[model samples]
Target: MNLKKSYIAAIMVAALLLGGVGAYFGVQLAQSQDSTAQQGGNGGTFADLSEEEQQELIGSSQGNEKLAKVNKAFNLIKDSYLEDVEDSKLIEGAIQGMMDSLEDPYSVYMDQETVEEFNHSIESSFEGIGAEVSMVEGKVTVIAPIKDSPAEEAGLKPNDQILKVDGESVEGLDLYDAVSKIRGEQGSKVTLEINRPGVSDPLNIELTRDDIPLETVYSDTKEVNGKTAGIIEITSFSEGTAKRFDEELAKLEDKGIDGLVIDVRGNPGGLFTAVEDILKNFIPKDTPYVQIEDRNGEKSRYFSEIDEKKGYPINVLIDEGSASASEILAGAMKEAGDAELVGTTSFGKGTVQQAIPMGDGSTIKMTLFKWLTPEGNWIHEKGIDPTIEVKQPDYFYTNPLQVEEPLQLNQNNDQVKNAQIMLNGLGYEPGNKDGLYDQKTANAVKSFQSDNNLDSDGKIDEQTANKLQADIVEKIREGNNDKQKEKALEVLFQ
Candidate 1:
């Protein structure tokens, strides 16, 4: 369905959980309490009722034995607990317990503070390291770091499994609790022990939290296969991301680039509306973008309606970090024959969550629906595999770079080409790997150096060259290691 209708549904269902609880126990307790309070003053107890009256009360209360037992436990906790507990806390705890019983990770109860933080994270800036994270394979994994954010600045990469925060193991922590542990006051330092694939030992990295401004769409131009191509990287789908994407596409069209590379590498997805709006730019008018099946087995289809397509050959770059709205966009484009997907499989997250705000400033992010591609494919646990599977370099996990001779900018040799391949594989865009180092190549080298805690002088000295080559060799040793961008360019040029 459309976003407007979905929002209305969310508002209508905001009090569903509490209302259900109130229907079951709240009314009965209130009626019994009011009778006792009026008869025997405010300090009245259920003991005032005779045994027969208590049985009658239970009988009248829906004849549900479970409700009676729950009320018994509530009163017991209130009377015999060592510490006085607020009724609100007890009620919220009940709600949390109920949600936890569902055993669904996406279904959660947000406290007032958490609700506010969640809203702020989507709509505005927040104090954090700025990484999109989720529970992957039962571990808290970094989906992708936001570009230029503290997470990226600290060299955090996608698929990095967070093992500990401040030396505390997060083995049994939920996603929300893990995120809370990582986020703190701005300028505060947080240390993360990460277990990345292909690495034996965990690596500890410290990052300073910052007020991260949320920006989803970024664009630039890159030369591929002797042709200039537009590269639009969408970090995540946020509010107004569609508008931003349209503006960027317009700028790229004005440049008249040969091809377009839409990079949703580490994007963990966001608003459904944002994805719906952005998909219209590339897909044909009225083409089905995504379909959602609700609770009652009712299905709704979202379609694209842009009359004119960009028409440029499009290549979508994805990795394990790409999920949710990223999948929606990529799946739509691929199914519509509008783009060819490059890179590795996307992080599968086919369910849709509706954030319903409660009256008490708390919220419930419930997974209300499951989404499918235009071709009716369910990629929930099973990810969307790339038509061209290009694995990232193994050195990203191996921690060593290999090179023999020092390579500088403007050098034309196979060594420079190898360095370029290694750099691209490591997520550094060092122009084309034609064996000739250009200015973009130097800048990419500097960026890599800065990220790896080395000198950022834009020159590949002996030390830098060795590091780059070591990474390449490690990838080669891992077998079938080549540049993903190279395959992408080949597809676009073909």
Candidate 2:
């Protein structure tokens, strides 16, 4: 029994002895009161003893049979152990055991070295081979490569299972150990062997680590439906994101863009103020953008503050990769009828994480709050489903970072054909919607790029594919078919 319970039991026993001959009835009554008091802390009192007597009563349980096993274990460790050990280490081990018992992948106790590394990563940016890795399905999978980082330059992609690090087998290593292997001094090289989906052989990549600059907003423009559509991929709501997004907006305006596509895929999310500032550029002042609800049903509303709406009918692209602050952006746009969400449902991580610093410099990140849309819908486990569902094109470009389990190639791979078909339907006229890519298709692709202010290389990269796969064209088509584009605009502005 624990010390608290032992002390309480001792008091009860003492009270029973003090009452003497007629104490049986009183003892039963006191026991009932004690049980009720323990259940809910009802300010219970034991009036039968003085302060000194109470202390003595509690001390009587030190030699009780209930504590015999604990005492014996302590004696054996102190007297018969082969080596002398500190009591503090044993206590720390016990604490570690308690955390292990929870069986939660996210929650873990960090030792000194781990604690220091985690703290440094959060504060000062470090040099490393930049890839977000997670222990998923009993293997370390690449969530995504940081843009322009060593991993991205080496062509790492999401969902690539890492089989080896620096030629060392990673079969039994934990997530932390794998991360440690990947991180090192700048200019140092690390090699990763990846096992990816739909690839023939295990892909090997050697990357030189570098200090990665974490930017929040990335933008590019492309042509669709004979019109220039400016695409901005927002990775996080960092302090610089609003200014970066505004810069992109100005560039798009200068280029006379006709449409906008916002990519929020694989965006882990960040600061609320940054999100609000961003919403201001797209939404009208006084429009509800997001809401936070507490367990007590008290809600706070966050509204857009822009006086004028500047956003062209926007299309927000999402997938199982987008999360947190990204959801806030997508949820707000969808609720306000400002943007049409395309692609798969998001990552469904709606809860807010707060880092509480311990007396030591280490901090514990705990999920303290949850986020909601302006409509007051909780987005915890249930993510926001897109108005238009589109899958990420799997066959357009092979993942060079890792080779997946061999596919039964006899099955039809239709992603390229799907892209061609979708591109044709949008009107920027790529040649014939044939499954095979030819010279005519390449010419049309170049024309589209030159007109849209893109790199004009005619090569369909992942970013280009992301834009093509979005639902902007489909949403526009649906509006045209219903003959409601004009009417809907009137209602929306009104």
Cα lDDT tens digits for candidate 2, 1-494: 00000000000011111110000000111232221111222222322244466456546867899878756876788788999978756644544554455543333344556556644564435578766565555577765555546675566666688999889988866556677787778899898888877665677877898875555576776655466777777765554667888898889889988777777765555555556667767766556676654444555555554676665677787766565567888898898746778767876655543333333443333333445787878886567888777653322233331213321112223444445555564555656554455555555556655766666666555545545544333333232432212222222222
RMSD of each: 13.9, 17.2
> How does residue 270 of candidate 1 score in lDDT?
63
Using alpha carbons, what is the TM-score of model 2? Answer: 0.58
lDDT for model 1, on a 0 to 1 scale?
Answer: 0.66
What is the C-alpha local distance difference test score of each model?
0.66, 0.55
The local lDDT score (0 to 100) that residue 313 gets in candidate 2 is 71
Regions of candidate 2 where Cα sits further than 4 Å from its true position: 1-105, 108-112, 118-125, 135-139, 167-175, 193-206, 221-228, 250-258, 284-287, 293-299, 381-383, 391-397, 401-494
TM-scores of all candidate predictions against the true structure: 0.69, 0.58
lDDT of model 2 at position 182: 74
**Candidate 1 — which residues are off by over 4 angstroms?**
1-66, 121-123, 136-138, 223-228, 307-309, 399-482
Measured by C-alpha RMSD in angstroms, how accurate is candidate 1? 13.9
